[model samples]
Target: MARVNELKRQLKPGQVYRREDLTPYSNAVDRHLAQLVRDGTLQKLAQGLYYFPKKTAFGTPPPNDETLVRSFLKDKRFLLTSPNSYNTLGVGTTQLYNKRVVYNLKRHEEVTLNGKTFFFHKTPYFPKKATPEFLLVDLVNNLDSLAEEREQILKNILAKAKTMNLAKLEHAVDEYGHSKTKKLFRPVLAEMKKTRHAQ
Candidate 1:
């Protein structure tokens, strides 16, 4: 009991922890974890994942998506994004999606952590954060998977692209665009350049 109390003292609220992380603090790590869960000191997010929820006026908020994924992956290099973010580009993507997408180097499977669905995509590279340029490129990369009309969205995307920083958009295309996405953007970029030079 004294050792368990000692272990509990090490936990910080609003943080996620893996069973292995708690092991060094307790000789009977599994037993202490079970006790903590039973006493509401920790919430089991998954088989080995736990969260010490922070209290708020409304209620205890769920763990931050980034924190949850970081604990689960044991890596901080990942991009958390959703199709819904594309709507902010003003390219007519208004359909709300229930899915959350995580682009990382480690996993490629659908997982549910603490009632939220996450699609873990293993990719060669991804930005540390999702910028507008990255989101635009990503929108095209995952176009087929989205519920929006692809043709209309593509047209709107090109129109929207014209209004953004040409260099950043081109860089995002080169760095993150898939083969088809590259093919789609090449001519549009060329045309934009020609128009700019003509002006």
Candidate 2:
């Protein structure tokens, strides 16, 4: 029980933890972890992941997306973005998506932790955070999966591009945009250049 208390002291509410994190406290860490879950000190999110519940007015709050994801991936090198973010690009995407998309170097499968769904895609590269530029490139890259009208979104995005951070947008395309997105954006960038030269 002393070891359990010591482990509990090490945990922060709303933070996710892995089994290996507790091994330093006791050799029988698994049994202590199971007991902690039974006693409400920790909530098991998955086979190897657990979270200390944060009590609130409503109930125990779930772990933040970053917390859960970092624990699940066992690394900090992943991007957490949602399809819903596409709606913010003024690209005529109005449908709200009820899922999260994770671009990571590993773990290419859908995961459910603490009642939230996370779709993990194995990608060679992704930015640490979602910049407006990166989001735009990503939206175009995954247009087919979104519920909005594709051609209309494309049109609006191109029209709005004239007012965006052109350099950053182009850089994002060069770095993260897939072949299809690059092909689609090439003419738009050219048109923007023509308009600039005309002015």
Candidate 3:
């Protein structure tokens, strides 16, 4: 009991923890974990992941998505995004997606943590955050998976692209665009350049 209390003291509210993190605090780690979970002091998010919910006026809210993911991947270098973000670009994407996408150097699998779906995609490169330019390129890269009219979205994306900074958009395309995305944007960019020269 004394050891369990010691372990409980180590936990901070609203923080995610791995099993190994609590091991050193308790002699009987598994037993203490079971006790803590049964008593609602800790919520087991996944196989080895746990979250200490922070109390609030509304109630105990779930752990932050970034905190949950950072602990799960054990890496800080990742970008969290979703298809729903495409709606912000005004490219006619209106569908609300339940799953979140995580672009990271490690892990490529779909995982459900605390009832939320996360699609972890392995990529060699990704921006630290989802910039508007990156989102546009990402929308095209994942176009096939989105629940929208492909042709209409493509047409709208091209029109939307014309209004953005051509240089930054082109840089995003060169860095993050898939082969098909690059191929699609090439002619559009060339035309924009020609128009600028004509003016």
TM agreement with the true structure for every prediction? 0.96, 0.92, 0.96
Model 2 TM: 0.92
What would the per-residue lDDT of candidate 2 be over residues 38-84, giving only the tens digit for each residue? 99899999888999988999998788999999998998989998998
Instruction: List residue ranges in candidate 1 displaced over 4 A.
Output: none
Ranked candidates (lDDT, high to low): 3, 1, 2
For lDDT, candidate 1 versus 2, the one ahead is 1
**Local distance difference test, each candidate:** 0.93, 0.87, 0.94
Q: Kindly list the per-residue Cα lDDT of model 3 for residues 55-174, writing each as its tens digit.
A: 999999999899999999999999999999999999999999888999999999999988899999999879998989999999999999878999999999999999888898999999
Off by over 4 Å in 2: 56-59, 197-199
Candidate 3 clashes: the total is 0
Question: In candidate 3, which residue ranges exceed 4 Å CA deviation?
Answer: none
Which pairs of residues have clashing backbones in candidate 2? none
- Where does candidate 2 have its weakest 10-residue lDDT segment? 157-166
Name the lDDT value of residue 15 in candidate 3: 96
Model 2 C-alpha lDDT versus the unseen true structure: 0.87
Weakest ten-residue segment in model 3 by summed lDDT? 188-197
